[model samples]
Target: MRTIRVIGIGTGDPEQLTLQAVRALSEVDAVFVLDKGSEKADLVALRREICARHAKAGLRFVVAGDPERERRPADYAGTVEAWHAARASLLEALIADELGAGEVGAFLVWGDPALYDSTLRILERITARGRLAFACEVVPGISSVQVLAARHRIPLNRIGAPVHITTGRRLAAGLDPEADSTVVMLDADPRFDHLDPELTIYWGAYLGTRDEILRSGRLGTVGPEIRRVRAEARARHGWIMDTYLLRKPGAE
Candidate 1:
């Protein structure tokens, strides 16, 4: 049976890859890539650089066009389900056509696959269809959440306190009062803009790369600065990937 390794490539920094992840990359016969477009071409190029550094020479890269989906839809969950289905179909064909018997294929995912990434889920969908016969393996890597805390010199959770990880959409609805510390990911908008002034925020963008940006302070005082800087960085780079930590004072 063909094997598919869902290797977590961490963020952009190639040095962030664990020895185990590097070993996995070196073994794979082919790596699958999705073309996200010109604006995010740097992301694809970064993946190629990583493969060049770690994988065996002459490793094949199978690139496919990423399916388009609505950025904002009335039914967000439904839209995402459809999008995943499309991706599963695309990847299934790649696996069937490109992967030979007993050969290894890989998807170099950003951060940890167990996090917000959809590659694993898409693979599962293809497997559930029973058309593809491949074994799946996951190699973990450093996540941006860890990098954020380290860069900011702050613990993700207060002493003996729990940390809640959520998205920007849920953050806008409201935070759970009991949440001592919250980590927000995949937030394009500044949902923390209207939050309590006393809350502290540690925000980072383009994490683990040379273009990394970090900001932290009371929400009220630094909120505007974050907004302005985030906009300028996005405009300059044509894309942005960010995550943040929000904590209540004396939550512990």
Candidate 2:
């Protein structure tokens, strides 16, 4: 089996795709792209653009869907494990078919594969079983955090203040060792409703795409606005990848 290079295509912009990423895209003999669901059509389009820009002659292409995600049952822990298992199974098949023919394969990872992305971990599990033999490389790109800060033009941290990266789920579960700034990602639960929001908010959705929206203000003041904007964008585009940085008063 040939090595599979997992490429982080970055947010939704062609420019955000790194040079190294382009090279990886061109070099692979085959590539497998994930189609999570219909609502994520824009994501698939972004991959199409990448392939159009860098895919070279003789490179095989494959598209795969997530096997299935089981709803968390009463024993939530068990359900979570099952979900990972299902995803693992789907990826295993893709790897075998794409790489078994002695062709190098790659998967397009949204954002950087190292940041809260599970493709690398799943590959690790598959490789451990000896069912697949492959080398992997992660090509980094601009993250939403960096893009948000740039658009807002505000330092993510105050003098000597630390920043914590968390998700809407973790924030709702209860923030940990609270820092001066907390970055919220995968914001499905509208967690800002739980925060004071007076400190600051640098929110962005569909970052780098033409339909991108960015806003910043008091969380208490901008929370509803962000929600509205997020909903309208989701409705307009069928999907969203928004993030925000929140802070406590006087921390900035």
Candidate 3:
């Protein structure tokens, strides 16, 4: 029997790691962290920092290189599917080498595994390989949304208002068009430019660490501001995770 622990390590701050996530880290024999090579070394380092600060037991870490994401719509889903398969195969090999028969492996996910993350799904694909029957568990961590909300002291939704969480891709396509409040993530593109500038905006970058930046104003006004800040932040950090909340008036 093989078991893999899928643990969310939160955005960047070690303080953001949940107690349960810490417990899960202590129990795993090896922690697999994705190193997107030199450009985003900070991401892998964040997991290491958390483990050093909170891991009760000494554990091993394996830094796996992440495959580049497929951006074109024509091949996006299929490309992601293929990427998962490849990642699973690579991870399975590492798991097999470490654990001959029964062993536990942990993956330190950057964000909550349940939200916009695909590690759990890829782990499932690995289990279906039948080489080793695998069971998996998740340890949730603080997400960018929580960080953004808390930083701004704003409720995601007020009373009867609805909050829709979506990707930058969908927002660029005009969002649901009917959502009162929308939270956009994974947005490399400046999607706010496409929307009606009347929408109020709250944008956050590098959301939970020392270098975190939070800015907001009317959409039209801040879009350019965020674009400028976003580029500088990304250049400084080498990587960034940002989320924004936009609402057309009458949303709440």
Best-performing candidate as measured by lDDT = 1
TM-score of 1: 0.98
Q: Which stretches of candidate 3 lie over 4 Å from their true place?
A: none
Sorted on lDDT, best first, the list reads 1, 3, 2
- Tell me the deviation in Å of residue 121 in model 1: 0.6
lDDT of each: 0.92, 0.79, 0.81
lDDT of 3 by residue, 74-181 (tens): 877788888888888887777777654566788888778899998888878877877757678988888888888899988888777678998887776786765788
TM-score versus the correct structure, for each prediction:
0.98, 0.91, 0.93
Per-residue CA lDDT of candidate 1, range 1-252, in tens? Answer: 999999988888999999999999999999999999999998899999999999998799999999999987899999999999999999999999999999999999999999999999999999999988999999998899999999998778878888999998889888878899999999987756568989998999999999999999999999999999999999998999999999998744
Q: Which stretches of model 2 miss by more than 4 angstroms?
A: 70-77
- The parts of candidate 1 lying over 4 Å away from their true place are none
Output the worst ten-in-a-row residue range by lDDT, candidate 3: 95-104
Enumerate residue pairs that collide in model 1.
none
The residue-level lDDT of candidate 1 at 125 comes to 97
Range of the 10 consecutive residues with the lowest summed lDDT in candidate 1: 188-197
